[model samples]
Target: MNPKKPPVPVPLLMVIGIVAISFSSIFIKWSSAPVSVQGMYRLLFTSLLMLPFARPYSGAACALRLKDWLLLGASGVMLALHFLLWMGSLNYTSVASSTMIMALEPLFIMLGAYILYKERNSASAILGMAIAIFGVVFIGWGDIGLSAENLKGDMLSVGGTVAVAAHLLIGQKLVARMPSYLYSLIVFISAAIVFAVYNLVTSTPFFNYPAREWGIFVLLAVVPTVFGHILFNWLLQYASATTVSMNILGEPVGASILAFLLLGEQLSGLQWAGGVLVMAGLGVYLYSGRRKALKLQDSLPNAS
Candidate 1:
């Protein structure tokens, strides 16, 4: 018998995903529209772009039971909440602070994975996570605001992190049932609906935005939604959600660099130090994970 081939280039795709998602903060910062409106169109455009490709997977939806549909819908709502909260946070807090808060996602994800799926990381991986988180804190330590508005933004960011974690945890079981694209399509559509409803309730204008804002929306959908998140969703078929979240830790570093270049935001020596620590931690995490995977693979023959 032959060994099984991998379905996709997991590492390459992960890099692409991380890089793509790093732009999210930049695009969100450029937009002057309401957060709900941004999210509505981001997901809406994502759904429309995915529709043609996703139609082939339509039959997969029929095979899903009500529980699965409910899970998908719930995932969407959680995702919507995540965008609304996180994007809203940017208005009141610094990008570094918001992204730092978002870095807490892996810890949230690990806890949820263990609770829901009984998944656990190796000791080394956990240590790496700790190191990376410390780096993130160090980077954002000076930038964290003490003002009431900043506090509100930090709280909102925390909510966004929890929402995203919930979204991933809810989808953990369902991602295995259907194709990744199909799964993403349904979830995106559900999120779009939630955003749409929220916009309607708030009486926010749907079409008053200038061309630049519209471009931002489209870029958000294309870069982050398509190349970033959808790739991670695809990876869910092969890797644990915890692994994906670990990869997401790089987003702050990427975003920070982008901020310096594109937005002309200044980076301090402390930020650079923190960036190095974050990379080192991620290296350790990936090394541990890879070693464990190799050990598991080696043991398969003995078990057989």
Candidate 2:
């Protein structure tokens, strides 16, 4: 018989994730290194930190196959490409438009899962996702713009969102069996290696950055990269990709508050309303999922 899984506190971990990732944008703004440089260092530091506890790297006997490692590598490549494309859009599109487009990630995950794996959502879950998305529109309502010139950037943002969704989807399969830190270490190392090669090919210097910038890189690694993102990776063992993605929608709310405290970025009245809606939607949706899961568990004995 399979061992019973440990109870993971999904809500709490997701809250931690939101707060952790909220610092990501701030770190990027604070860094002076090129995007590739900053990304490489962030992964490098994160992978190093996670290395000590990572089961895959600990020389323990594991069930990992060649295909498994390749899937992890693919997931890492997709994540790297998501960053490159999303950031690349900034040159040609408004930040608001990009944010809005990137926000489509949850939908992509849901749809992709349905198509590729026949995963389905409950009525309440679908409702929750829609409401959360509406809240995002309110938060970004003022920033969104449309123009002929933004086509390429808009497309890139959409593509980036899809790539990120795929990353999450890939993780859903393996997160159950792999040690959390081990999975994160592998993916982080993979991304770092990819970025390093890309930077090297393009002649981007990897060293001698300003101390202030390096500090920001370390913060980025600790905050968003590890606590924020890898925490999500860890949480996947207990939640569906769609649900996890929904939880991530909380980031804009947390990020806005962080920005106000750290960078003096203020939220408009509509954005505040949007934040409320996001929290409410997530609460309702997650509650629904919990109820359903409990119901299924209760039925298992009778069914057997």
Candidate 3:
């Protein structure tokens, strides 16, 4: 008798992971700490939590060349910047605005893949991108009445989205040749170092945070940074990037609900409509891509 293979449902895990990550904004908003300090503590706790799984020295062994190290380091820097910018945007704009803008990351990723990696972009993907952008615009309009401050926040969120997209694309390359956990370890350590230096330069007191703030920081690190990212990386082993990317549309909806229940923040009817559009667009894109990929696979020659 053949041995049975344990079932691992990747899509379900990815959904749960992303929903957990969506709560990160709520935690950040709940804590009364400075954004820089919050970012520092978040990275510190995440690095520590990841240490057991990553085993830095052994992970470092997986990087066989200077180019690999450079790519990993770049991804880490981009990730740190993404956090910094996204968190900072929260200070200037509503969480709804920030999250909706950040939801544009899939569009950036699609564009980046096309430009950088020469990946082919189909009409369905382009239409999906446009629809997603419209949804973001709708959400943004509902957040702050199109004021300058809100516009600034929207731009910052967009910048963060670009940074994250770059990190993902580069990270995909690194993970393809090395262990995912190892690559993640290097990225986290690098992000920690960068944020530490940034905190030092800006005179941010890292050690003086209140206990409650520390608790929230630890929660953010453990829940979103570590577990969320680990599950996402794991899903990549079973699913395509497009499939995973489309699932990210769930984040804003989750965040909005948490913000409403926890922080008493309310979303407008327009914003809800925007969220629906985002989900619909992403659904169409992912479904179309999967069909295309399956057709291609079916047509490929197989070995006897």
lDDT of each: 0.87, 0.77, 0.75
Better of 2 and 3 by lDDT: 2
lDDT tens per residue, model 2, 115-200: 87798888988888788888878886765556665888788878878888999888887675676667777878888899999998
RMSD of 1: 2.1
lDDT per residue as tens, model 1, 1-304: 1123356666777778889999999999888999899999999999999888776787898899999999999999999999999999999987888888999999999999998889989899999999999999877887886999999999999999999999888776787778878888999999999998998888999997899999999999999999988888877777778877877688888988898898887778888888888888988998887787778779989996
What tens-digit string does per-residue lDDT give for candidate 3 at 137-255?
67656675577887788788888888888888887666656767777777877887888899899888878767898899999888887767666655554554445565666677778
Question: Model 2 compared with the native: what TM-score?
Answer: 0.89
Displacement of residue 153 (Cα, Å) in model 2 is: 5.8
Residue 249, candidate 1: C-alpha displacement in angstroms: 0.8
Clashing pairs in 3: none
Task: List the candidate numbers ranked by lDDT, top first.
Answer: 1, 2, 3
Enumerate clash totals for all models, in the order shown: 0, 0, 0
Question: TM-scores of the models, in the given order?
Answer: 0.96, 0.89, 0.89
Model 1, residue pairs in steric clash = none
Off by over 4 Å in 3: 1-7, 55-63, 238-243, 301-304
